[model samples]
Target: MSGADQATRERLAEEIRSLRARRERLVDELVQSSGPGDSGDASQELQGGDEVAAIDERIAELEKLRAGRIDVQGVDPGTEVVLRFSDGSTQTFKVVAIPEEVLAGEEDITVTSDSPLGLALAHGQQGETVRYPTPDGAVEVEVLSIRRPS
Candidate 1:
């Protein structure tokens, strides 16, 4: 009902902090790109400017997710889930509110809230089979289990 979950909020806050730090470093690079009485590298300046702008945009986006979001829909980021493919093969994935939430961790597979598969799985219960479209076509996956990360 609010924004992102607590873990997602913390990750977003950390990401903002990291981006800000990188932006500061980029700013310093921009300042150093040109020296007194020296011609500047226009290409480098433009690239740094673009990167800074992107960072700023991302920071703004993350800042808005500082509350509860997916929980209101019955699931949250950092939720570990098991799924069975149509072939009867099973795999585990950690559900995240955003693509950026895939941090280095034990869970290598991730499902973001914005993706088609993620959208299909949202608010799904165990034993529910959800279908989502992919470039190849539609795929069906059965939810085996869903639990918060320990």
Candidate 2:
């Protein structure tokens, strides 16, 4: 594990912690809003419901990320890696526990650790070629480089 990788893991852990805190706060607010003493406005209730649903979804996502969170010691989840395909084309992807919306607009691709390619590349090293099952057929990709999140 490199220093950079460790730093990335630390940062991710902190993010998870922060998200958990936010979720808790949201839950508390939802409870307060739905209390018996609260005003019985239909629109307000509907809005509160929507907010709770959204917060619940976010909490679920955060839990998934926490469950799949990776350490910095290996080519596991949470590592950013570059691969060279058999056709001589290269691409970079960040191996995550769950696909993050924040990475959707980024240059690099984000792959979940449970995905075929990510599973094959788990614990892989640079210069190693790993085979993963594809829709067309099995494909082999070589690990060109591995980088931790900045």
Candidate 3:
């Protein structure tokens, strides 16, 4: 893996940890705020508190998923691989986490370490290839090299 790619992955892992911590803090606050409500306005405030708690819960879930990384075992961080589609065309892609900028979209293409294609590639050695079936058909991908992102 390139020095830069390693840095990026480490940065993302740190970000996930930070987000989890923030979510935990928010949950604690929400729980403390919703105790022994007196009624009327208090009930309304409790409802609001609960809503905030729900949001925090969702954030926590996302953070957990982000933190629970897949084992790229044999695959190194910087791997130059190809995805050969059923059309007999191949595209080069380096497997990595979904960039923060691309998180809202392009998620499938970004391919997480846990994703089907990503997982298949994970632990794969150089010169090894795997095939995955898509709606279009089956595509075979070959692993050329593995290294941390550059």
Candidate 4:
């Protein structure tokens, strides 16, 4: 990896850490706000429940990211990759620790490190073939290329 690429990866990792911390703090605050024995209005309690649920979902995603943290010298998170299937088909996807909600409606596809294919592709090099087992059987994919976003 180039100096710039390494720097970018470090920045992204730091961002993930920062976001996780923020979410943790938010969850704590929500828990405190919705504590039992508090004589709060029913509507307020209902709203708090909704907020808690949303925060819980976000926390779950962050935990997945924390568990999938990678320190490999190659194929780090945030790298765009092209995979060639056995039948001569190719697909492009961005390897991300967590999916970016801003790109939710975009055409770009992202794969998290926790996923089966993502786990197999992590730290892989160009021209390397990775096989992952599925319900039907095993699937083999070739890493055609890995590129850093511009």
For model 1, which pairs clash? 3-68, 3-69
If ranked by lDDT, best first, what sequence of candidates would result?
1, 2, 4, 3
lDDT of each: 0.74, 0.67, 0.57, 0.65
What RMSD, rounded to one decimal, does every model reach?
A: 4.5, 6.9, 6.6, 7.7
lDDT of 2 by residue, 1-150 (tens): 222244444555676677667767766776676746545554576776777677677666555544554342223556789999878999988765544432536625877667788778876789999988989999999999987545
Model 1: lDDT to the true structure: 0.74
Question: Candidate 4, clashing residue pairs?
Answer: none
Off by over 4 Å in 3: 1-51, 61-78, 98-109, 133-139, 144-150
Better of 2 and 3 by lDDT: 2
- Candidates' TM-scores? 0.64, 0.49, 0.45, 0.48
lDDT of 2 at 134: 85
Error of 2 at 1 (Å): 18
Error of 2 at 18 (Å): 20
Q: Distance (Å) between predicted and true CA of 96, model 1?
A: 3.4
